[model samples]
Target chain A: MIETDQLTRCYGHLTAVDALSIRVEPGQVLGLLGPNGAGKSTAMRMIAGFLIPTSGTARVCGYDVAREPLKAKRALGYLPEGAPSYGEMTVREFLQFIVRMRGLKADAAYRRFDEVVQRLQLEDVLGLCIDTLSKGLRRRVGLAQAILHDPPVLMLDEPTDGLDPNQKHAVRQLIDTMARERTILISTHLLEEVHALCNRVVIIARGKLLADATPAELEQRSRYHGAVSFSAPGSGMSQEMLGRLPQVASIEVDPLDGRITVFPKVGERILEPVERLLREQGLEVSEIQLERGRLDEVFRQITTQETDGARDAVAGVNA
Target chain B: MSPIAAVMRRELRSYFVTPVAYVFLVIFLVLAGTLTFYAGDFYEREQADLQPFFVMHPWLYLILVPAITMRMWAEEAKGGTLELLLTLPLTLWQAMLGKFLAAWLFIGLALGLTFPIWITVDYLGAPDNGVIAAGYLGSWLMAGTFIAIGACLSALTRSQVVAFILTALVCVLLILAGQPQVLDFFQGALPRKLVHAIAHLSMLQHFDAISRGVLDVRDLLYFLISMIGWLIAGVLLLDLKRTR
Candidate 1:
């Protein structure tokens, strides 16, 4: 388990992280979502015991990070931002150094070493120096070192920041397999990654927690939730006709592609009514989708509101 | 293995992988040989001891020890591995000590490789082998002091060049503290007791005493205490930087 209470860090007058409290229970993959410079990496560093917070506390497996750093650090594995490692050492040597630093014994270290190497598909490049590897392979080596000890909690900062699509899929799959037994916290700006891997999501902006909810709950806050969209070529569809339905709230047409999207009234279903209307009009729709919710839209809405809110507060003070 | 040992092994191995170790070793050996023979006038002095060799260590180490230790923490900070190493289940002291020991050992290996001088003296005259061994021990101890100073300064910045320059500047001040020129300049301005205390703080004074075949407990303690003091300062600096 990982828990932090009111963890804050400040540089001079600028507060990088502010009163951020979060909890990640066992077997839960928590996605920390934020835009650039949102203090995601700073928060992770404090939790990992690399930086001391200006106030409050972080704990891993019941050990307070500041009070019992060794115990807390031993119980957690952190892949720092940019996945930094010794570039001069070979992948095998660097991993071996990590295993040794973890104080694993001879036989157990060997077993864990082989298991992590094989799991990360790092056996082929074990002898290659980290500096010579491509960005994707270097990230794999960083991941291998972080998981070499098999700690119960893992924190990865931008784990897939520079990987190709195939490598991203492979890494996501690995995290999926490991998610069953470990409490993993991954920070990313990629909304698709939150949907693909996270069971719980926390959004932060300007170093403060903006919203904490599951992926579906966050999507529900979006305007696109429960909306039906379809494309029809050269078909006559009137906004007034769709507005006549009791379940319909509004309609939007794509100026470029002529794709029409019908939004539902609050807590109402409009897919059936929209289908009936399309059939009655003898309109042939090419493709259709009922969006559970658009996460990107929700993410933008939540984060931008926080920024605007801060801007207004500054304006209020100025006035 | 313990965390300190693990860190030390990795650090020592990394030195070999880069050209820093080879370059430092070659330069140190060549300088020591040249200074002992030509600069110290060993052939003309007809000395039966390695005084010519031992006397040049403080000056030689002022430039070279920083070269070995400048990258100790500066590279880690620049490369972002400082976060990786600090987050491991080890205290800052362990990492600092491990890096110091590795650099000190590398210097010791370079010092050891100069045994051909000892053989040359032995072949030429009946030299005092016991005194030569004491000189070697004293030289190694003094190198430890320089390594500690360099490592501490390395932790103060992310640029190796800055670390190297700062360490060299500090080492020069410490080595010159006991020189007659500095002391004479200070004698008229400062009180006698303060000048005496400043001389005592000079690494050159203590090292000179030990290298002259006198194994004073005070001289050994001076090196040990200074090494520990500088290492503690380094650990504190690392902690201070973390919060910054």
Candidate 2:
């Protein structure tokens, strides 16, 4: 439903988005992840037809954003970074204005309006001016406007930024439900949100695409992938002895709890081997488990490595 | 509804929802009343014509029109709603025209409310109603010209104060171009034809021709072309900003 062909946007000496390309299929929720100044918003703006890409092209539902802006915009709804709206307008007034601008028929517009108002729970504040609403409420109002016309594609930048926990959950739920019928591209810094909501994740840094894959696939790149952990009562097996095992690459002992974590060599099956070793070594094992890697750990590794590389590049220039 | 109409409706509703519409109405009516009766000396002249009233419109609008239009695009840029509006399915020209018509209609409403002055003139003596009607048309055209320039300036920055001051300054120059002192500045330094060209560009000169019931096509074309020129410049400026 959305595609970009080497989308590039440069501001003088700094490139905001650099030769970035992406494709989002229908019914896919794509979580765009990056650190500060990572070109996430710039890419989304180009897709939404608000900003012209310095080179290449962005297309939504088969229409080029620059060539056929109106058509591309018709197929997409965008919630910008701050969720700006007409402060003087009431929530209902603002939504209705959008509906009219979208060119919906009267009956269809009002019905859709009522549906979004109820869905976003904006009934009580319908008559209040937008500026008078709290941050969470204002975010919900922004959500309501984006979903009001029920466009087939959605580009949301920080949709859950200011919401309280419950409101954030509500918005995530709404996005989850809407993903069944639309293509969603959401940019956020929250790793957990990406895990919980996105089927596909794309990580970028310094205007370059760094990683793109499923959440599980990205997690597999972590150092802790397929590691094993067990808490035992004073296992007499020394760290050196365990390190001798062919499958066991490293082991960590928690001093206070006397628990041991075993990391396997790449492509090695250590769970069975470690269990057999512990059984033969006279260790009283209370708990043992195999684990998938943590997404947060992998996220930090990937993003920080990129930052360090950027710093090194700057340092190299100085040298 | 068309794109322009939709935008105009929203813009008009926004005007009333804030204090801008009410405050503007009050100030405009008071100024018009005071200027006509006190400064223009309408009753002392003892003529049924509304010459005193119509003559003050350009100067009144020099300040007031910019006040109304300074926020037209500047507020959108500041509040970040310009992104939302542009990303909608409307063309740039459609949005600009919509906003322009909305402000133009608002100025028309303010001009319309001064009907009591027209009634007062009718009651006192036999005034030439044709000339009065022509004067109103002329005033509305001049309002459009001022709004177009203000709209262009508003697109240059996000600060409404800056937009207001700059628009007022430009309109002052445009209105003062025909004054004797201004023409005198060029009298010896430039040729007679060049001075005439400068005077012809003055909004006051064209408006005076129209208000006196001489509805020349040249004056009409002058207002229309200038209005379109400024609006096109405003739209281009907005597009330039979006590229960044």
Candidate 3:
């Protein structure tokens, strides 16, 4: 539903968003994962037609953002960061205003307004002033305004930023449910958020996307960090000896129970190799299991974000 | 155009949606009434016209117009919703004209409330209602000029303070352009042709003509061109910064 072609935005000398192109499909939640200053928000802004790219261009629903912004914007609903809204207005007033701007019929507008307020549980606050509400409540109202028109594409920047845990859960659920009919591109630093709701992850660091894949697939792709752990008799096999064994890359002694933990790199079957090595060495293995990298672990590793190499690689891929 | 009107409705509604309109009207009425009866020396001078009341408009608008427009696009930018508005299927001109016309209509409403003064003038004596009407047109047109400057300045910064000061400064220059002291200052600096061209651009020259019961097309075009010029500048600034 949205596509960028070598999109680069420079704020004077600072390249806020490098030549990074990404495509989000309909009925999918694409999480734009990146650290602070990673240009994820900038990318989302450009696609939303709020910020023009310094070079290249973006399109929404087949309309070029620079050349035909109105056409593209017709298919877009943008939830900008900071959630700045007309605070003096009531929740209902704000949504109705947006509905009117979208040119929705009065009856249809109110119905859509009611639907959003009900779905986001904003009915109680509909009559309340936006400035009086807490941050979480305010965010709910902001999100409500965004989806009032039911646009085909949504570009949400830090959608769940200030919400409480329950609100976050509800918001994520609403986003996930809404993703069934709309294309969504979310820019957030939270990996759990992406894992829980996003169908595709775009990991960007320093204005580049490092990894873009499914939750499980990203974990599997970074499978080099898998490890096996088991308890063995200390009388025969020492943890030091296990580390020296072939295919057992390294061994760590569990301080509490003295169990041996082993990590093996690629081309090594961790479980079988550890089990055989322990038995041959006269050690009675009590328990054995292999643990691949968790999603969070892979996220931290892949988006470790040190040098510009990976950012360049991702930018190259996007281009 | 419907979208533009829709935006205008909301923008105009925003002024009245809060206490802004009521407060603005009260302030305008109290100031206008005070200028008419006491400070303007209207009763003592025994003039059966609204000359004293409208004489303060160009100065009043230097402060009031910015109050209305300082938050126009700057607030949207600061709030991060400029992206949402820009991405909407409205052209740059639509948004600009929508916002400008909304403010213009609002200034018109505030100008409308001065009808009591017109009524008061008729009550006391047989005032020339035609000249009074011309005066009203002239004041509203000048308000448009101030609003255009305000609209342009508002787009340059997110802070209302900057917008206010810059708009007031620019409006002051426009007002002072044809003043005797200003003319003397410029006469030594440039040739007569340039001075005449600059004098024609002076708000005092055109607005004073209409205030004296002359609704010349030249004066009307001055206000419209100035309005469109600043509106265009506002549109360009907004279009440049259009993004999420």
Candidate 4:
């Protein structure tokens, strides 16, 4: 329900968000991943109808953000970075204000207020002023305000930034539940959040889209995909010996954890053969599992490559 | 509710919840009382009119109105709530007018609380209630003019202190443009029509004409037009920042 066509934003000589286009369909959760200054938030701001795009168009539910802002804004709910809120207002008051600003009727506003409060578990701090609440509580309040209206399109920037582990999980669950019928585009630096909450991931760096795919698809890009990792009690299997096993391309032994991770050659299955080898050697395996590769590894690979390429271009100019 | 009313309610609620409204009311009332009795010499003049009280309004508003409006948009920008506010389905005019009306009503409340002074004048002598009524109306319009200027200035910066200082300086210059002391310097050097135009632009001059029970449509239009002009300018600035 969200689409941007060659959307660009420039501040003086710096292009904060370059010519970019992205589409988020209904019932799909998109994880927008990028490092600092990747223009993720800027792109979100433009789509939310807050910042005007320097060129091109951002449309929500078929309404142009620049032309029919009110209609486009009506379809979207945005949680900006830092979850900034009016500190003087109580949590309840703030949510109520948001409900009204969203143009809900009194009965509908109150009903939605109760629903979001219950969903976010904000009952405890309902009457407390926002400034006096803890960071996590404040973030929840901010979240409650954004989703109170239950807009069709939700753009959340770091929705779980300051929350504790439990709170983060709860918010992820909330987003998951909401994702059943709406379009959600969340930008976060936490790679695990993409795996946990997003079905589709869009990776951007230096104001350009580098990769966009499913979490599983991105994970498959890692060399560690289909690797087998097992921990044994002081097993005498050296890295070289483990590497000699059929289909085992490489092996690594963690000195601290005593885990042996064996990477298979492309298009090979090493788990069955490795298990057979361990059985033949009479070594006790404490734990063993197959991994789909680490998302963090792929994230690092994509973002760093962009930076390195930029550096090489700079060097080429200098030469 | 309409978007304007919705925003107005929120802004008004925030005003009272913080210390800004109370502090502004106390300071404004204290200064009004002080200026009326000490500086304007109300008791020494022994006049049955509220001329002394009416005369000090433009000056009082020049300083205090900025205090009331300095944080209107500055705090929104600083705290990042401007994003939340602007991204809503409301138009820019709705939000700007909502905030401006909230501040104007707050100043009106502060002005309304000075009823005891009117009562005192009534108890002491047979004063012209019509003139006093006109003074209140004129004072309210002048206060709104200052508030609109302050709102425009507040939108230009993210610093409340800067908003207050710049608004006060602008108000001072506008008032001084018509002051006898300042106008005398230009009287002999400038053309007559140009001097008259400059003096006519002063908000203080329009307020004086109205407070004297003249009730001129031109003076009322001036205040209304200036208020709308400044608020429009504030909205334009916000629009500029949005694109940037």
Candidate 5:
């Protein structure tokens, strides 16, 4: 388990991370969602015992990071941003070095080494220098080193930031498999990654936590949740007609494709009534489905609102 | 394995993996041989003692030791591997000590490879092997001091060129501190006691003493203290960077 209490870091006068307090229980995969420069990396560095926190402290597996750094670090696996490794070393040499540094006994080290190599499909590149590997392969090597000791807590910063779709899927699959038995914290700006891997999401912007909830709960905050959207090629479905329904709260039309969306009032189900109206109108609907909610929309709304609120406060102060 | 030993093994292996080890060895051997025979006039001196060879080590190390230590921390910082290494389950001092020991042993290897010169000297005349051994120990200790200084400065920046230049500049000053002309220039302006203290700080003074077969405890202590001082400074600088 990972826990932080009022953890804060300041750069001169600017508070990069502001009194952040969070806890991740065992078997939870927490996704730290934030914009660029949102202090996700800074927070992880503190927890990993790489950077000293300005105030408060972090604990990994019941070890306080600041007071018991080696103990805390021993219980954690951290992959710094950009997955830096000694480029001159072959994959085998680098892994061997890590195994030694981690103090794994020879027999168990060899066993774990072989298992990780096979799991990551790294047998083909074991002898190749890390400098010669592609970005995706480098990322895999970085992951391999982190898990070499099989620590209880793992922290990865933007693990899939620069990968292709297929590579992203593969990495997510690896994380999903590992999530069952470990407490993992990964930071990314990619919203889909949250749904795909994270059991809990913490969203922050400008170094401040704005929301912390499960993926489903976050999606529910979006206005599109429970709303039905349909694309009709030539039907004249007026917005006023849909808005007049007792269950409907508002209607939106996509000008580009003429797809209409009808939002239901709170705790109301309008799918049946909306479908009935579409059938009665004999509309040639090409496609229709209910949105679980758009994560991108929620992300944007939550982040922008904070900035806008700050701007308004500044304006009020100036006025 | 101990963490320090593990780090040292990896660092030493990396030196061999790249052309750094071979290139440095060749350059060091060629330069040491050329300077001893040509500049020191080993043949004309008719001295079986490796006095000529030992005298050139300070100048040789001034140029070469920095070459080895310049990338010690600079490359790690530049390539972003410093973060990866530090986050591992090891202390900062362990990593620093590991890197320093690796570089020291590597230089020791280069010094050891000069045994052909020893064989040549022995074949030529009856030279005191005990004095030669002392010279070798002093030279290796001096190289350790140079490496510690260079490694400390390397931690101050991410640029290898900057680290090399700064280390060379500082080493040159330390080498010149005991020169007669330099001391004379400061003789009138500074007090006699202060001048004497400054001269004592010169690496050449202690190195010359040891190379001459006088293995004074003070001379050995000087080299040990200088290496320790520089390494401690390096650890502090790394910790400062983390807080900053």
Candidate 6:
């Protein structure tokens, strides 16, 4: 498990990670979501023992990162931001070096190296110098190094930044296979990644965590009322007057076309009235649909700090 | 032992892979050999001691040691491998000591390749082998001082060029402090005790004394203290940087 008690890192006048207190349990994949410079990297570095927190402390398993650094470091496998593997070494040599540095021995060591190499699909570049590999291949090498020792906690910063779609799927699958045995904390800004891999998400902005919740809960909050949109032909009066009905909560019109989005109050169904109004107005609608709130929608709402404008993490709590 | 030896072995092997180190070793041997034969008048006098070659080592080390130590930490930081290294099980002091010792040994190997001079001098005349041994011991000790200070400076910057230049400037000051001409001015202008104390801090006095077949306890202690002291300072600098 990874836990922090009001952890923060300050550099000169800027606060990188501001009093972040969180708990990441074992066998769970926690996605740390934030924009660039959201203090995600700083928090991960502190947990990895690469950067010391200016205040508070981070613990890995039960060991404090600062006070029991070796034990903390030993419990964690960190792929730092930018994926720093030795450029001078070949893939095989670098993996071997990490194995030794972590104090693993013999059969167990070779097997561990083999497992990471296979999982990361790094066999093709095993003989090439790490610096000579492509960005995607080098990322695999970095992943290989991080998992070489099989530490209980894996702190991966942008683990799939340079990977192709196929490679990305494979890596996500790899993480899924291993999540049952380790606590993985991945810091990425992408919403789909959280939807695809993580069960829980923590949204941080400008050095502070804004929200943390499951993807489904976030999506549920995006809907303030029922919205059902579809194509219909109006034969009578205007569609705008139809919205004047008591059942309508909101009507967001797409000005260029006749497309309209209608939201009613909680537990209210405005679709039947809207459908009847569209028929009476004699209006032809090509397409109409409700906004399906995914993790991306929730992320947008949080990054813009538009709490009132949308819902997810906070909306769920209020509900 | 495992940690130190592990780091030291890799550092020593690195010299063979890079052109700069190979070139350094060849040039060092050539210069040491040429100085022994041409400057010392070895062919004419059949000298027994290695004083001529040893006398020039302090100057040689001023340039060579920095070249060897400059990339120790600076390269690691610049390449972003310092993060990988710092996160390893080894402590900063252990890594620093290992790298410094490895560089020292590489320099020692380059110096040892000039063994033909010892053979030539011993073959021609009855040279005091003990003095030749002492000269080597002193030269190695002197190189230790340069390596220690250079390693400390290496940890101060990410640019190897900056580390090299800083170490070279500090080395020049040490070399000049004990010069006869500098002493003449200091004798007239400064207090005797202060002047002598400053001179004693230099590598020259001890290196020169040891090169001349003397086993001075004070000089040996000076080299030991300065070498270890500078290394300790390097560890402290690393800790301070890490905390900040």
For residues B76-180, write the lDDT of model 5, one tens digit per residue: 999989999999989999999999999999999999999998999999999999999999999999999999999899999999999999999999999999999
DockQ of every candidate:
0.94, 0.82, 0.55, 0.84, 0.91, 0.51
lDDT of 3 by residue, A1-319 (tens): 9998999988777788778888888998999887788898788878877777889889888899888877788888888886768887888777876776778887877778778889999878888888899999988887887888889999889999999999999999989889897899988888779778888888877776688788768867654446787776663346666677677776677789876668785667677766766677776677777775567777777767445565778799999
Query: For candidate 1, what is the total of clashing residue pairs?
Result: 0
Looking at model 1, the pairs that clash are none
Per-prediction backbone clash count: 0, 0, 6, 0, 0, 10
The native-contact fractions of the candidates, in order shown, are: 0.98, 0.87, 0.61, 0.84, 0.95, 0.38
For model 5, the stretches where C-alpha displacement exceeds 4 angstroms are: A237-240, A312-319
Window of ten residues with lowest summed lDDT in model 1 chain B: B204-213
TM-score of each: 0.99, 0.95, 0.90, 0.97, 0.98, 0.89
Question: Between prediction 1 and prediction 2, which has the larger lDDT?
Answer: 1
For B5-72, candidate 2 gives per-residue lDDT tens digits of: 99999999988988999999999999999999999999999999999999999989998999999999
Best by DockQ: 1
TM-scores of chain B, in order: 0.98, 0.98, 0.95, 0.97, 0.99, 0.95
Q: Write the per-residue lDDT of candidate 4 for residues B80-198, one digit (tens) a residue.
A: 99998998889999999999999899889999999989998899888999999999999999899899999999999999999999999999998888988888988999999989988
Error of 4 at B123 (Å): 1.8
Worst 10 residues of 4 chain A by lDDT: A234-243
Task: Specify the CAPRI tier of model 6.
Answer: medium
Docking class of 5: high
- Residue B45 C-alpha lDDT in model 1: 96
Residue ranges of candidate 1 with Cα displaced over 4 Å: none
lDDT of each: 0.93, 0.92, 0.81, 0.91, 0.93, 0.82
Candidate 1 per-residue C-alpha lDDT over A216-289 given as tens digits, one digit per residue, 9 for 90 to 100: 99999988999999988766645567789999998888998878888999999889988888788887888878
lDDT of 2 by residue, A187-289 (tens): 9999879977999999998888889999999878877788888887756555567789998888988888877889999999788888888888877788898
Give chain A TM for each model in order. 0.98, 0.90, 0.83, 0.97, 0.96, 0.84
